[model samples]
Target: MKPVFFIAFLFFSISSIVAQPTQKPLLHGKNWMAITGKPLAATAGAAIFQKGGNAVDAACAMLAATCTMWDVLSWGGETQALIYNPKTKKVIAINAMGVAPTGATVDFFKKKGYSFPPEYGPLAATTPGTPGGICLMLANYGTKSLKEVLEPAMQLAAGYPIEAQTANSIERNKTRIKEWPYSRKTFLTRPGEKREAPEAGEIFIQKDLLTTLNKMVEAEQQALQQKKGRKDAIMAAYDRFYKGDIAQEFVRGCQEQGGLITLQDLANWKPIEEEALQTNYKGIDVYKMQSWTQGPSLLQALNILENFDLKKMGYNSSQYIHTVYQAMNLSFADRDFYYGDPYMPPVEPIKGLLSKDYAKQRAALINPNQNDPAMGPGDPYPFENKTNTYLELLKKRSFSTDSSDRQFMPTHDIRTGNSFNTSTDELYQDRLWRGTTSVEAADKDGWVVSITPSGGWLPACIAGNTGVGMSQRMQSFVLDEIINPFNVVAPGKRPRVTLTPSLALKGGKPFLSFAVQGGDTQEQNLLQFFLNMVEFDMTVQQATEAANFNSNQLWLSLGGTKMEDRKPRTGSILLNDNTKEATRSELKKMGYTLSFDDRTSGPINAIYFDWKHGSLWGGSSNHGEDYGIGW
Candidate 1:
């Protein structure tokens, strides 16, 4: 997509709309901005920027650090990113998502008595993607050496002070971690004691993980010593991880633990850099990753919302919430059925799916009065000159219209939402990322990056001495065509994932780089976050902290192995506890079964380019470990 700059009039930057103070102070930077899931991780990005590396380099640093800390992800998880390369003046999607390995198929899962892939263990893993993701980004767009970018992560692995959130999670899941001997040895510092996991502030060390990172760095160094070009040297490291001893150990460990990945699977897996999917909303070009991720759902949401007068609706007003929720329900409904591995597909009618005519058609189906419990995927085939052959399958779909209060939601009320509630949050999280994390970075050179990486999380099973946790992304695949033919488990095909990173451009320049973490709830929060800045004029920080609502009107992308467990809870809405009682009552009247949580802030992180001021505005969510550093 060409940069649609030279709009008749320029959109104003963040202004008085953010009159209310945000919980986190706005971070301003004239040269660089770095933000992610943890303070240390962000700091790692900052260090890279200080070292004169570009946005891609800093983001790679942050990715490595978060994975090392198991900040909702591990080395073996997936990485999906959207980067604005100023030199190219284009948004590029990094499809670092791994594919289901050999022997991973619907029949394989069914015979194992699973309706879906298991939530954890080797069975739930696809090939690891983060290592390749990091190497690729660094080699292509970054000026830094792999050795430099990995230094922070390597340091973290050698024994960084562990935080309470992660430490406690390890303690709580010790039983499950114990099931994997390698994991037990690494995570459970005191196997037989009351607390097998390390305590808060303890210097948690991963000797094996450090060694693994060192090996990759060594590979890069060896290639460099041989006079290899920077990119080739990084690829050398990439090859070592995927085709050398690393892949061998990972395969041996995986098969030993009942997983399907073969060394061939690791060798064959490669990351793709493609043009980002785009849609114009009021002249701003918004970009998202491909269908393999849920990113496009946000693009579709924006298309539908474009037809509404959101500014007049007022932020969080019953009408606003209802309209936005309905739009997302429409978008996610389509995402559930149609989004999948675009590389393999019953070719997802993506061209048709993003067509304005199709968006208008979907928008027209939204009722202004109440939630549409029967919301399902729309046929985009006609827009692309193909008759939809799966309309019959869509009709056979099932969802709950009961609107009953789910005991599960209320339990995740204020306390659960404020901080990580190990049990349900862990489940809700990869359930990731029903478990995942986000990374955002930008530099004065116009380079910007947004990444939502997920998969291997706490209680993660280790892959032998590789110190890498296997990915649970395989759980994202469906076993039956009735659920999603495009997303059914198949060897060498990617599981449709919840990870998405977004970028927006106005007047032919980078306007925003942002992403968030939450399983299926990703696009819902991102859609609102974007509107908060564009429609409501909230500052990036204000938008990041603003209360948002979630709709559970689509099939969950993560969770259990049973079809019933992944079923949609129609008309169920998660509202911030701070919502006015009247607003809550009105939503209730609109057929929404409201659940309250104080922190629906997305744990969102973002960098907004204020061209007029020639500065970067950074925003990190007011909850969890999300943090940012700007300079």
Candidate 2:
């Protein structure tokens, strides 16, 4: 063969052997930017930003829009957000998770002849906090009125094209919706129209939801007519749901169905604005909601891992994954044992958990050669409370229920049969269930908001004629209390939720605003994303597309389970096929169960601001219906 001809042939062979790398288009802008789990919502939010609304205004708009487009998120569920204000240089955490009804108690279920609370219907519903939280955010931070921010979502609720993903969710939950008359009438059927499930690309109209949204708008207008300020008008809109006719119907629905909610619970409920928890790692300050969530678990894990050279370990290497997994397992063990509502009795101080010395103490527990199947609770009790028996404190709210591995809500147990007869407390029997739409926006003026709104869909039971429903967050509360004092259910106490959103600052300036809807895995993904940018020097888009993994080694957070069942599994790791085959096999040989399967990677929507260049770069996981929009 001729020398030049042979060389060309070799080049072609090598080129054909190598595969092209798939990359998602990264969104760039200067004026403003928004990313969300749905395109319509992102567009709606961007429109708000274009209409002179700031980040908070855009977030509120996007949140409601997500409710309209995605069956997984609903206005009637719950929401939590972290907003960073440039003027004050402060990060505020919004804890909008609903609280158990005032009547909720261990005895409440026992009286109904059930061992524990049912995971569905009115029994498991909490006093919803999303509406109050949205209004509060708008009134306190946003420049636009509630009527203005909600206009796009209101129009969307009236009618929009149903997408395939949401259609499938509706199809699967059709039977559950049929269990409740209001849910059946409102979701499964239209005016003189009936169908098994909505078809993709069909014009889906939510007349009932539209009516519900209009009532809040009218309430806002009525307050405005009363010569009220815009802030008061927003609060009035919030009140219409919790204190006016809407509350009446919501309470009545629960009462008629033998549920525990009351008018008092609705009248007194308010979403609180709390100071966010923060920890510094590698020059970036990470912020999260307080202990009533899995937020601090991220902080705790970061604290433990900060002692090591994560960059030296290399990204997703066997040592890196094992070390991070062990740290996460340790933190989650502490989370399961101690994290809970701060206001509730027997609350432990979080100061000890986030302390550097404490982190060093916990970091010493990671075994280099093997995954620890059981890492028991830590001694986070401050020096002052060293003698406190945390286990005894949790015993105050103890009860028993069938446990399962499903993360969030209960799965239907065919053994019990499907019956709404809570009289026997077996209502959730045979009722299989499961379960963020995220929105982020940053304006030129230095305002940034990261919000994750979720809950109230077809699987959720609707309140009678109110076009509202309650979140199943009550499921997160321990039916049978264990060592985790913070998670025990109490009247008016918020459940320690998995709905965590996060924000960060670099050099005391707004740097990154990001979040995900992966339940417990949210923090794991966020940690990797942040490291990819800060440690490995990857762009926001490249870090987002980096190979991700999830370890189910720890006890699931979203649902209740037995103590024995809470031990970490032999460190199950689920990775994408893009991960190197050699790395996968190496990790498997290290006693880690590895699965190279592609599943729905949670949309890790993020926006990174380069203040020096005045340029904004945004990335979205594009999972299902996710999208990023900027201008």
Candidate 3:
């Protein structure tokens, strides 16, 4: 298949009306700008930019403000970031994801007579990585101090009116929130009241959370007074939570709630900064987090689909959706079967999965006439550097065995528009990342960052008066010994999380940075958006607003449950209202089950850096985490 090089001749022939629509164009500016899930967060970032902070500083500020959005993200959360540093002209990935506690072992759960590890308590909680993650960014790449970046979040946390999204999340998880006294007092309507989530526009005050943030700031100040350098002061603030009094308090809270997290787990916890997993797609250099996340799924799918004529198939056509969806299934299958923590001994090399040769082999399996509903993982072991546990154990295990009778389902409200409820095997059961949110920022100097910070909800217990909520990310780990190697429970291993923020490059320059708020759909949504930008030549705004199509057709569900029991219904494709009716009908005819919704994925926030124009264009959706501002 021939790739579509820049077809300038075709573009030159387009009519003027088609060139520029009458609708308002994207928010444009020559200065720094931001696109975030919440308006307050966006504004806070813009304010930081106005105060002469670059993209990293703005991102820290925006994320701090987003913390007030307790229903979307929390003070106790996880963060994964992909940043482009113009000074070095390099892109980096930061893994702020927490690791399973040393005490969290597969044997422990089995001996406890539980089918899977705990899903909603201290046992499920990983040490909170968000505070350390954001602080690391600020200390290394930002111009402001930790206190400055956290100012807006602190102000908002003190007293900010609750928005619709947050209020809705609060009401949905109210039952579990009431179980923890600290959580109930901090998140609910009143001290001991059982009232529902406050209505939109209702004043919501988090005095406890505010105090916690202030204490961190105070710790930073104390370090500054001790004659420490800026970076040292930031580390001091980070230590206040992980290695100091806050850590002690969290350990106590976990003990009170029957959680297994200990002081050692909190003290040893630190976010990792590593090179981003990257691939050459067409001429664009695409980047994502390593195996600890589903980020590689995007690159794998891109590699597989590169052998096809996506543009020629026509956007949103049945042929287009089928081809992309099939490729996605294959990638997700591999993700479930092979992808695992890189910290583990031997696993499939990410490079092998993203290789063009592997793509040729994987792509050759795609059938144009029909959908391969049960497509499983391919053997990438031959492409590996060493023996892979997954491949070694493959024959001994039942790759096709159906464990549907043990499907794990967490009850959540349908009106909340959560994806798990729309599926049979509980696609939402992957992790407790329902409230994840994202933010992006860029400045004229070419500093760019895409960060997704999430966690800190009430369904799980809180860390006493410290106001930090425990992360239930361990829920993504599989209890089965023979399951995917990447998701196996191991001491000090980071769970395979879905928190991915992406950055793309063109001609070795930062072209775009983006992220979204969704569990398994995060990578899927990002892949479609990236394709929209390069293949279809859609503007950032057009791509951000474009109808999204995502599929979780892979048989293996999170937590090692099989989805085969719902065959014919095992896999599902979600389409937005804007998708062509003809395409939907064609998809169904292709033997694919589908769901129609206007909002197919979480709100996507993106920033496009135009070197030619020396301008920045920010785009956000009309609803659900859509907020953008530029100077």
Candidate 4:
């Protein structure tokens, strides 16, 4: 062969022989590690670890930083977390999700001509939760003081180099931001200029937010000086935020903007710490948050998926995708109908939903040949040996297929056969794949934490001088009984949220801790990530970079001002562009309307406990700006 041709041939052969590599390198550590949505926030967590804090303390630091950075969430948003305590040898769930305020009933919204909760503004808010959540986690689990944990966030609030992602989001949503006086004052650095938001790399300072953090730290300091214990001191700061001056200012600002929250509502709200739900996948015990957050659906899907030989089907194969999609659809159907605030009336049938027998019954309904678009919530009440009190009501509930017209209320969108409406498709997609930041941390002391905290994203309704953004979580509730008797809108009820964190334990030791961004796609991507690690033997980094698909066959848990906007698209699937053409063809033949993306592995972040090597291996995907630090 000619010399030039031979050289070209050698290069081609080498490229073809080598396996594809991950965009981000795998992280390795011996003592501890921290991972989150942004570089600075991850650095914040790392700082806490360096200061000798445990995983819980580091996780709190990361959470505060992410909220401060406006990385698709804020301090007023809800926080859902799963923490593995080394001493207790157990995983615990932190339910810091806020409740609806007084006058936030179905009748109140209907009277105002709203089909569902408004997508944005004061009307959509639940009482602030993240502030209380941080205090609770720090008080009960963390070894650090509130002053120590809030240091990084307070610094960021004072001023930090803003990234283009958040800066540009503010610019784009400036019109909405202007509607709220405090938001306009905090976000619009240049009132009349063409570029009102902080420029990328510009120092973005939030004086009001900084003041709030200072007040919290001051309250803690005062309590400590008075000889209060660490936990008691933390609770003192919590009280200041909820029942003291902070709460008064927050309520005044909220009501000024036509919101429903009251001082009583703020005082009544408190974070709950409960036993985390778990399911044994093979010999590994997987843990998730409770049903109120669409978390147990992942467990339910795991149970249904347990019936299949997933490894035999091959990862991302047509058969694998089909079976997984069917399982998720079934799990989500039950979630839409039965999951609700357990603290209120109409107790959720959680025991039944998590039952293996119920999973088997759900699994039996899946069609091997194609998608079953008419699947509805199963009768799990029977599995628990109790009569389904709402069988008649469930019967009255409308069921629709890909081409059927359906309605739960007079204002619900009326479908007209399979003539797919394209006008609102973009908005629908936005809600399905909406973004949120994830936090994961672990230490050699055997502490592990995974959290998927969200709400109060860009265009937030800033609550007065407090500088706290109001949560837009009310949209997750239904206004009608027939649609979801359990999830109906009512004062003080928590909505069924999409934020879910995951952890797995093997042989009574930490195995893996993981979480992802994206609304309804949260569980879908997490399931695939877990399977890649457990069944396919992929490394944590490789699993995060692997291709994953999303199903739009379930109702959206975020956004959408009307039922029409939240409606599910039967048989719609989002496939990674790397998907095999053969697999796509097979799915298309089975009644799926497919879409494609190059990045679908969740922008996921994870930590794998390499017990064999006695070390921690971290994974951060290339899909987004997720970063991790290890030492």
Candidate 5:
């Protein structure tokens, strides 16, 4: 061969090898890493790992950077996390969700004669929880000093570009931005000029945020010099932000703006530490955050799915999609009616609802061809058929049934009956359903991570000052008598959140860590991702890129502009061959109102450890406006 031809051949061969997908290695010994919504946040964590910090340290660094860069997502907002240590094989759960101030009362809202508002301003604010959560994580798990971990975030905040994501988020919330002075000053360049969009590589700066972080670092150092333990020092740092100088200013601003938060509320606030909610799905150990939000709802959805043969039923078949929608509807109804702060009252026994036996029973209620408009909660224990007795009891309760037109169900004619089903003998089978046998082993190295961050979109826009904007979060519902349908309407009552962060393990080895950002779609998106990974056997990227779907079955009232009476939401279901033939037709036959949009589902940040390859693969969703991955 000619010399040039030989060189070209070599280059082409090398490129082909690099282009093929490679298995990620399992991170043995100790691995430090972080995944966030912004590149700068990831950079901070990577910097910490390079400097000899562990996961906790990297998390702290990432927390600060995320707060600074993705102000709407982080800041003093609440956070939840799962942290695992390999040597000890222990996982701990952290609850960084915000709480209503003590002075909040439902009666107060009743007297005002107005219903609760859902905007994130002074009216929608809760006590900021991110500071406390970050501090606690560092105190319990970190070896790095506070100053060291926070330095990166502080520097980045001093001068970082407004990424396309942040700019878009800012523009979307422009009306709400006008509620707070600080938000207006920081985001809006002029009084009447349209907000500018930042180019991809442009650096955005927030001098005020840098100042806040610097003050926090200094206070932490001072506390350490006084011989306080790590926990105490961290607490002191939090106090500086919430109850010290910042607190006084924040309280005053809220008071002047007719908000309800008080100084004592800020000083008395503390992050709750709770046991993680756990379950086993087809042998894989699935873990999630508990009540006050929708964490348990995902478990309920999974449990319901387990009762059905998803793959055999065919992907997204009308029948399959209808079943899944029914499951979500049932779970969501339970979430709205029963889920609340555990401190106030015990949440309903959701675990039992998601149990295998329960799922089987629930599955039996499905009428594959028709819409069951108002399926009541199934009896907790209806195993033995009491036909006579059950009928008599039903008569006493004045039971009634009604048929509701289906919305969002697929049309049977959309796909020619192109069955992808292989015969039992020809079916490609691997140990896909081996069950999460090694999940317990993975738990040994697991960490419980929970984040419940809050922001004051409306209040901050109106307030203008950073300090003033921070106060609005605490003014949400605190009254016992207020009838706020969503959690955001009531002060101290937790917001109905879409803040699900999760981890999955196989064979006592760390498998994946994942999270996403969407107002009410967080847990729903997560449930789909989990199903895609386990049941569908998809790669991380494929699972994320796969068309996503969600149902408006539960909070039909909260569907906003997307709500429909006769059709199920369309775009929620992916239009793949498998789904088109199976889910779409079956669901249409069942009758559902559906609408379709080409919107990105949600952004999922994930780290997958491939034990077989001895490499770690990290990925972030490119769909939802603002996420990316790096080596």
Candidate 6:
């Protein structure tokens, strides 16, 4: 038998031998539901739900706990949230992305003989957005007091047993943690101590963060005493955090440590209110946060898939994987070349990209037998030339370990240069980042909110304050370039992001609230998850657990000296002991790179209302402790 046929036969033979059970655990309950990446974090949200708080309230609590559990993703980071009001059946997009400081300008860096600092440095950092984002959601849609929402996290932080997941995350990022004094002090004790983790059922505490929460509560109380409305009081409290004593001290410390933030950056920052991007797939309404993040990429992927008979190709079959990968490459090519801050010029032709007519035209370009060295956005639009150029650069720059041998000497010489120019040019060009997506939705009571929060790559590594890590997201925007590119770096522009959170409504009712958190993998994962639910009729758990696949075609720009024509095609396929050899054989003949793992492909937590059962079903990913509830 041919090599391809042999592999295919093996796959089918293995699958036929053992069929995994389809029914899995599910969450079912009364009034409210919440799902998040961390179990403790989920408990924080679930606690609020039990207290009669709605999704917004739960999200606020979850955000606080998440900040403590994952210091890298903190309150200081930016956030965008989408909320759906079941009553109004309306979806609102809340853009809480941090803004570049007023003092920030490309000319300023150029004048200083610095390109862009790494993301962890003060220069790369933007105004913090979570405080503002949480306030916005509560003020507009929540019923519980700030104290009520934050108290659970405070208790958890004060002394919760460290969990294995948290411990593992700490271990994985130990090197980065050792650089910060506060983080070192908090997470690690004298070098030889046994590593600690909050066991299941143990409480973990974050005293410093708890103090911060208390201060916010006190400020809110003062504002209320002054006869402010609930929303106004919340804003007032947030102002105290950003511009009052805490802000002053925070700014001072950063300044003393060579950070670039200022009082004005904090004082003037305001979350933008933008329209949510919407599309319909398989008769289901899908909505995503727009612009700054790759929300539109989700729409674009779905548009392309609409042109293909996905079901006919069969799930996890090589043809299916290839088709999806080709679709993703096409959408990502557009993403790297066009998407950005809408306020900027040279915006990606999103409408044109999503048009059914355009999708059909683009779909016609897919080649099944061989990989396309370069995939370009289809044209009728005049901007195609510039877009293609950007695509070529991306293809040329993709990272590959094999390519390392091609330029080992040149890289050494460049690094040896004394000037910052070489370092700036090289490091700045090779960066990979993942973003956070937070969403809130309700069909009733007239409210909808969605927020995508993100921080950029490694900026300056601080010596002891893990919370103080700088963000390089600003590099995602570029001047005279597409509004949002994967690695945007433009004057006066915010970076394009992959932190899109979405809210979907069905029959004029709140249906789904979801988000995916992976750098470029975000949109593709989201697209796949949604398709698994609507098209394949998989339950939320099954949708999340199903083998996932994506193309790394657009990640070339971050490849540095290592560039390659062929990209990585990765996916998970379920095969039990019962499958036939013939089925697998045919699949291999169609061309798919493969792997097998006994875990879910992506982390996803969702609460879907099953009207027929008159209850909310919550499903959490089993991929890692990054997901699943501990309590």
User: On residues 89-180, what C-alpha lDDT tens digit does candidate 1 reach at each position?
Assistant: 98888889999999997888898899898888889899999999988888889999999999999999999999876787787788889899
Ten residues in sequence with the least summed lDDT for candidate 4: 408-417
Kindly indicate the candidate among 1 and 3 with the higher TM-score.
Answer: 1
Clashes of 4: 0
Q: What digit string (tens of lDDT, one per residue) describes model 3 on residues 117-185? A: 566767778778889898899989999988888988888987888865566567667788888877877
Ranking by lDDT: 4, 1, 3, 2, 6, 5
Error of 4 at 103 (Å): 0.8
lDDT of 5 by residue, 254-318 (tens): 65655566788777777776777767788777777776657777887787777777755444446
lDDT of 6: 0.58
| Global Cα lDDT for candidate 3 | 0.74
- Each candidate structure's TM-score, on Cα atoms with residue i matched to residue i, is 0.94, 0.88, 0.89, 0.92, 0.77, 0.78
How many angstroms is residue 165 displaced in model 1 relative to the true structure, after the best TM-score fit? Answer: 1.1
lDDT of 2 by residue, 377-475 (tens): 677765334655665554453333232233322231111122345444322321211125677888888888988777664477877777676676776
In TM-score terms, candidate 2 sits at 0.88
Candidate 2 contains a number of clashing pairs equal to 5
User: Which one wins on lDDT?
Assistant: 4
The list of candidate 1 runs beyond 4 A from truth reads 1-17, 399-401, 404-415, 418-435
Residue 154, model 5: Cα distance from true site in angstroms: 1.2
Global local distance difference test of model 1: 0.85
User: Model 3 off-target regions past 4 Å?
Assistant: 1-25, 191-199, 385-389, 396-435, 555-571
Q: Give the TM-score of candidate 4.
A: 0.92
